[model samples]
Structures are given as C-alpha cells and as structure tokens.
Target: MSTGTERSPAVVGKLSTLDRFLPVWIGVAMVVGLLLGRTIPGVNDALSAVSVDGISLPIAIGLLVMMYPVLAKVRYDRLDSVTGDKRLLAASLALNWVLGPALMFTLAWLLLPDLPEYRTGLIIVGLARCIAMVVIWNDLACGDREAAAVLVAVNSVFQVVMFSVLGWFYLSVLPGWLGLEQTTIEASPWLIAKSVVIFLGVPLVAGFASRYFGERAKGRQWYEEKFVPGISPWALYGLLFTIVVLFALQGDRITSQPLDVVRIALPLLVYFAVMWGGGYALGAAIGLGYERTTTLAFTAAGNNFELAIAVSIATYGATSGQALAGVVGPLIEVPVLVGLVYVSLALRSRFAATPPKSIVHHD
Candidate 1:
C-alpha cells in the first residue's frame, strides 16, 4: 500500500474516528433501532405513519442529509480526464452492468432457490449499481478519487435507464428461460426515476451547485479546507439516524427471523467477494495500476442499496421479505468492505504503480 502521504501504511490509523469505527456504530445503531422498535408499543406504526411513497418520511429526510455532503465532496471537475481513459470506462461498465448482475443472479439462485422474495430482492440489489458508499470505500483503500467520482456519476446516470430493464430481464425473463420460479414484483421505471431524481439527483445537483458557487465566491482553498470539514460530520450523523430509523421500523421482524437474515446475508457476502476480487484482477490484468485499480474494484463491488430498498418497499410492502433482504445488504456490506480496504492495502505492494501526471486531491 502507498504510505500515509504517499499511500503507504494505508491502514486504520488513516481514518477518522467516524470512518474507523463505522462498523461498531452501525452495529450499535442496529441494536438501538431494534430496541426502539420492540420496546415502544406503537413506534413502528408511528414511524411508518408519515410515509414518502412507502418509506418513512424520517428515513427519506435522513437519506438526503446523509448523501448531500458525500456527493458534495466529490471533485466533479475531474470527470473529463477520467472519462478519457476508454479502457477503464469499458471495464467498469461491464463489471457493474453486465457481469455484476449475472453473477448475483447465479449466487442468489444457487444459494437461496427456495426463497423467491429474498432472491428477487438480491437481484434488485445487483441491478442498482453503486452511486454512494463506493466512494467512501475507494477513499479508504487509497484509490483514485477522481476516477471514483466519474464512475459514480456514470452509474447514477445508468440507473435511470438500466435498473428497470435489467430488473425485468434478471428477475422475470431469465428465470422463465431457466424454468425457475419467477418473482411477482415488476421494477418500475418511475420508481427508479423518482428515487434517483430525489435521492441521487437532488443531492447531485446541490453538490455540484455548491461546489461551483462556493469556489466562485470564496476560492477553492477556502471551500475545500474551511467549508468541507464543517459539513462532513453530518454525513455520519445522517447515516446513523437513517440506520436507526430503518431498523426501528423493522426491528421486530429482523430480530424474530434470524435464520432468514443469515440466508440473505450469505449470498451478499459471496457477491461482494466475487465482485471485488474479480474487479481488482481485471484492473491489474489490464494494466490500470494501483490507484485506478483500487477505485475500479470498489466501484464494482458496491451497490445502490438505497435505490434497492426504495424499490422493494414501494413495490412490495414495508414489511415484505423483499424489503428485509434489501435492509440486510448494507448491514453485511459495511464491515466486509472495510476488511477489503485492508486487503487492497496489503495487495498494493504486488502491483507496480505509476503515478499519473498532475493529479489533484483534496481530502
């Protein structure tokens, strides 16, 4: 791994307390959410009372707060150079859109054949490519920040067009061809559009607008150094709040069905390993080098769970097995990917890294 300043010693010491202890906080949030859900008689009912298209309104607001800063942190100005590398672009797209979905389909079926709802939920997870947390993972692994930003922007755009189409192909058509039981759920174009528009699109535009105007008003240095840190803490706060609310609503069901959570978790664990490993191997095989390779692997491994959960709950119900499966995704992904960050660090020495000309990073 590159050292601290040079990407070497790319270890836990480099992370802030929030990022370093993320898994613990997430676990605590889950426990607290469960307690609130079970202890309070009408907590779930009250939380679910104010609904934004089936999801609790509090969760929706928390999501917006959680995402805005993350999106704002991305260096949108770097898109031009990243997109110039057609090889990296093509590899990322194939891994994310084509191979990623196919692999998840195989795993979900082979692993959870008897559970159609969970299988369908997993399939939706695969379809909703990463737009949010992958950047956090890439950063942790000392990956190329600009490349991740561009790739995430690409995935966000692709979701509008491809999520529904792929959802149909994988969940409905492919199953029919193979003579497996098909899921009754139909992926809605509008659902993806609205989620992307609100969750992804709204923050995206706000982030970009803030970057443009902030820099224009006070210069990049002031904005990056002064302004960014002030707002950074809210990201974790929003994430924790959202997690607490989600689990609070579904806590009873999740606590009750331990076996089902394990089953859903197994396929997701396998999916992350295969995707991350496969992505790194491909990047290294194709000579993308360390930084871009790390970015590629993370972008490939991560999925848009927010979109997946929103789609599941809106299409099914708040308490459906599909929604439950959707909730389990990040629960499994957070820690697994954190471990993978160290794996990427250890593996970095194996690759010969050639630094690009004049790459700018502010973190």
Candidate 2:
C-alpha cells in the first residue's frame, strides 16, 4: 500500500531474474529432487545415513546456509523504533500468532482431516511464520523496509520460543482432543528447539554480528551493496539443494503419492489469499499508513517454509508425508507471493501513503 516513491525501472530491474521466477525454480527443484531420488542408486540412503542423532547433517548444513543470508539482511539497529508504533506492531503479532495459525488449523482439519501427516505439515507451515522472503515481498510492494526488518527480527525471536510449543500443541495434542487420528509424529519441543537453535539462532547471531562489524569496518553502503548481494543467491542455492535432498530422500513416497502435493497445496493457497486480505483489511481498519500496512500484509501472509521444512524433516523422516507436505509449501508460496506482489503494486495508487523517511529506507 505504501507508495514510498515510484521507483525507477532501473531500480526495479535490480531485482534479479531468479527472484522473479522463484516459483519456477521451486518447481524445477521438486522435479530435480524427484529425479535424483528415483535415478541415483543409494544416493538417498547415503545422505540419510550421514546423521547426528535424528537430524541429517547434510540437511542441517543446507538449512543453516539457507537461513543466514536472510537473517543477515535484517538491520538490527533499526529495531529501536519498532516499538514506536505499538498499534501496528501489536496487530502484526496478533495476525502471525493468532489468526494466522487458527485459520490454518481450522482449514487443515477441514480440508485434510483424513491425512494427518499432511495436516501436521500444514500446521507446521502456519506456525513457523515468515522470517526470510517476506522482506523481498514487502520491498517489492514498496512497504516500509525498516518496519519489515523489525517485524522480521521480532518474528525470528518469537518463533524460536514459540514454534515448538505451538507445533506440539496443534499437531499432536489439539488433533487428539478433537478426535482426529492419533499421529505417531513426535513434535517434541526439544527437537524443535534444537532445529531452531541451529537454523534460526545461529543465523540471527551471525546476521547481527555481520551487520554490526561490517558496517563499522567498511561502511553501510559497501556492506549493503557489495556484501549483501553477494550472499543473497547462496540462500536460494541452499534452498534448492535442501529441497533436492528432501525429495531424494523421499523419492519412494513422492512417486507413490503424487497427488498428495496437490492436497498439501490447497490449504496453503487459501491461507495466503485469506491471510493477505485479512491482514490488509485489518491494517486499513486500524488506520495504519500504507507502508506499515503493506509490511503487515506481506509479513502475515508469507510462511517460513525453510523453517517448516527443517522442522518437518527433523520431527518426521524425510520421506514421511509431513516432509513432502513441507516441500509443497514453497512450491505453493513462491508463485502466490509473486502474484500478491503484483496485487500490491496495482493497489498502490488507491491507498494514500505516508512518507517512510522517518521509518526506514530501502537499499
């Protein structure tokens, strides 16, 4: 909603072609992963065998690499002003923690009650929330960059504490209470914590440290223009690599239950559309400025599929229905978010925007 200023085509063109076609890459990753899983003899087993405890070492490495760049982009210094807008911040939190998950829970049950593993995966996707790519979506929508960064930082910290508890309660306990099938899935908070520590916490610390020291040593321009752009693609590569590994591990299952991906996708599609509209209406109703509203809308709508995928693989085997469901999340999300980007752009002129100079600036 925030028309910060009409950015030049040159500025918009700076967004890499790969970023524009993220969904295509995701689809390609799925096919490639399936191919590798089916064709390569012993490859899946070989990767699966390389584990520390229940966590796959290769997948863990992939997740860490995928997460760090996204986390590193957060301007932690900008966070001092996040609390300055308490109403908008409170609404953002409520959307992510309450309405977001509640909607997914109800939809997952209503749509996929017969498929518990896939249901659990959808629930996991909902709880993880967006910490990474929402920044990209927000930026594309001309949202307040600082608000987006601060909200992302807040969500990252909140997710570290809450994801496991919520994942456990919703996936394991809530279902049983509702008389849904008792799933064998172990949504252990510790397991979730360990995954969070490795995937989210490490990257968060590294991102902040990188920003603090790099800015002091080299200056903000060099860090943002040179360093940030350089590391950005690594996140995408890491994601594709992890996806390949996940699907390869689950080749047998994927081959057998091809329609299950479609099944997992249905609820996610609804979540994105409904949550985006809901967040936008809530923001407009609460008298939020366009930039903040755009930030809130994208942040609420985007799912941290990276974290969801990691947790799914950790909690359930890579080949389990849950892991497959997790992969389907990004497959659904990338294109959906891309479409929302256009929607936001089209609606920009209709909404009045406050100057975001006091809030944040874009690179």
Candidate 3:
C-alpha cells in the first residue's frame, strides 16, 4: 500500500472518504436499479434516448469519467519494471486468455447446455477481462498501483484489438465442444473505434492533462483533494445508472426466463474462483510480495463488462444470449471481488510483514 506520510492531509482526507463511500453508493445504486426495473417498465428506454452521436450518452460519459482516476494514478515508470517481472506477466496472460476461457467454456457447457438462451452470456462473461473495476480493487488490496495501472493500460489497448478476434473464435471455433451452433458475429469497426474514443480515449487524455496541469499550477495536493473527490461520485453514479439501464433493457427477458440468471451464474462463479486462486498461487510461486500478488490475482480475475455489454447489444441485440452474459458478469463480479478483497488482506501477512516498497512512492 502507498504510505501517505508524505501526502498532504487534504488529499488523504479526500481519498479516505471516497474509499469509504464509493462501494456503499455502488451497492445502493444496484438495489435502486433492481427496484426501478421491477416497478417502472419503460424507464430504461427513456434513459437510453440520452445519446451522443448515436451512442448512449450516459454510458459513454460514465465510462470516460470512471477511467479518470485510473489513468490519473498510473505511473509510467512502471513500464521498465514490467520486463523485470516476466514470469508474473506471462502467467497472468496465459491464465487470462487461455486457461480462463477454457475453464469458463467447460463450466458453461456443463451448467447451461439445456438453456441455449444463456450460452452466449457465458462466453461473454468468460472472455471479457477486467478493465475499470480492477483499479479500485488494486487500490483496496494495497497492490502495486504502478503495475496495476500499467496492466490496465495494456489490457485496455489489447481489448480493443482482440475483442473481435476473440469474440469470433469463442463463438465459432470453440462452440463445437459444447455442441453449440456457430453464430455469426458482426460489428462495425467504425462504431467500436468511436465508442473506444468516447469512453476510453477522452477520459484518459483528460485525466492525464488534468494531472499535469494541476501539478504545475495548484500542485498534486489540490488536484487530488479538490478535483478527484468531486468527480468520483458522478463517475460512480454514472456507472450505476449504466448498469440499471443495461439490466432494465433486459428486464422483460430476465423476468420471463428467471432460470437464465442461474444458468449464467454457475460458470461465472467457477471462473472467478479458478482464476483468482490460480493467480494468487502463481504470484506466490514466483516469490512476489503481497501487493504484487494481489494485483496479479485481480488482473487475472476481473472482466471488462462495458465493452462486452456494448458489443453484445450491437452484435447480438439487447435480449440475445450474448448481452445476457455480459449483464451477468457484474452481478457476480461485485460481491465476489469484495469477498476477495478480504481474502487478499488475510493473505497479506503471509507474504510480507511490512508493506511493499514499490507502493511507497506517491507519484
């Protein structure tokens, strides 16, 4: 964990408050979404109309804002350290792309063969690695923030490039083992690039620029204290609203096919346990400290549901198997990650008696 002895009191105070309330607010937002979904029928469609240049405005803006803190905290110097830790990186990559997908596929086949409606849901959940939420998890776990930041940047870049390729491979080439029919997946590259620009590029650029300017003008203390806290809630609320809209769009299908949730949950739970455990063990075997281990574990375990959700809706329609799978990811992700945070804390003592030195630097 980053020691704050050198940090300005005001910045520390701001972060402390945000760290405390963000999760609670996120939980409440979820419940609110469920209630709204059940009580108000056309609410999602109404909200969906808030779009920019054909993209859903709330989701696009939420995605951009949510990434701000993530990019803001990243340490570019970590790129040098990445090469030094080749073993950890290779292990994470193999597990995330290879074993992770295979295990999810097997679990989905075993759990949901009878329910074809949710088969795509399983694949989407399995293939999408964590993008935004992992930053929060890494922060909470006192993980190597620099490494986590670098990994997230790398993953975000890779996700855009590999989404179509992996989506096709999973849907067509890998479906044979489950006796599933090959489904055609189509996405306009232009639209995807646009989404990536609005959701990821804008926030990333804005965050970097803000951090740079703040450091030069008011200082890092002022930026961290005043600006970050103010934006945090809005970003989180945007994410919650996005989730509500996503689930609301699928409310009718979910209400009708209640069993689909169960079907999607099984593989997801299995995938989470397997990936988290595998990453934890692998990190330990490589003799990494607790912070690095936690970072590696989450980097492997987390899924990028935003891109998955967008692609699912675009390629498979809102009510299709793909979109349902994307929706099921967060329902499983939130609580599971919270539990893992505790687990990480418990394992912290085993790795190092003191906090890792890597996390001590503020910048």
* TM-score of each candidate structure, all chains considered together: 0.89, 0.79, 0.83
Which residue segments of model 3 deviate by more than 4 Å? 1-24, 177-180, 191-195, 219-256, 353-357, 360-363
Could you tell me how far off, in angstroms, the CA of residue 199 lies in candidate 1 after the best superposition? 2.1
TM-score of 2: 0.79
- Let me know the TM-score candidate 3 reaches against the reference structure: 0.83
Task: List per-candidate RMSD values in Å.
Answer: 2.9, 3.9, 4.2
What does candidate 1's lDDT look like per residue over 1-363, in tens digits? 112244443544775778667768878997899899989999999998988775568987877787777667667777677889888999999999999999999999999989988988898898889887676677657687778878887887898898878888887899899998876666677777776677667777888898999999999999888888777777778878988887888788888899999999999999999999999999999988888888899999999887888889878876788889998888788778878987997887788744653143535
Tell me which residue pairs clash in candidate 1.
Answer: 2-7, 2-8, 3-7, 3-8
lDDT of 3 by residue, 1-363 (tens): 233232245544646454546567667766676667667967777767787655677666666656676567655445467546787677777877787777776787788777665776677666666766777677666677677766766666666676677768887887765567766567556655665566556766776787787778997678766765555455445556666665665555566666777778778888888899999999888877677788889989988776677777877787677787777788778778868876886676677542344553432
The 10-residue segment with the lowest total lDDT in model 3: 1-10
Give the candidates in order of lDDT, highest first: 1, 2, 3
Error of 2 at 237 (Å): 4.1
The deviation in Å at residue 134 for candidate 1 is: 2.4
Q: Among these predicted structures, which one has the highest lDDT?
A: 1
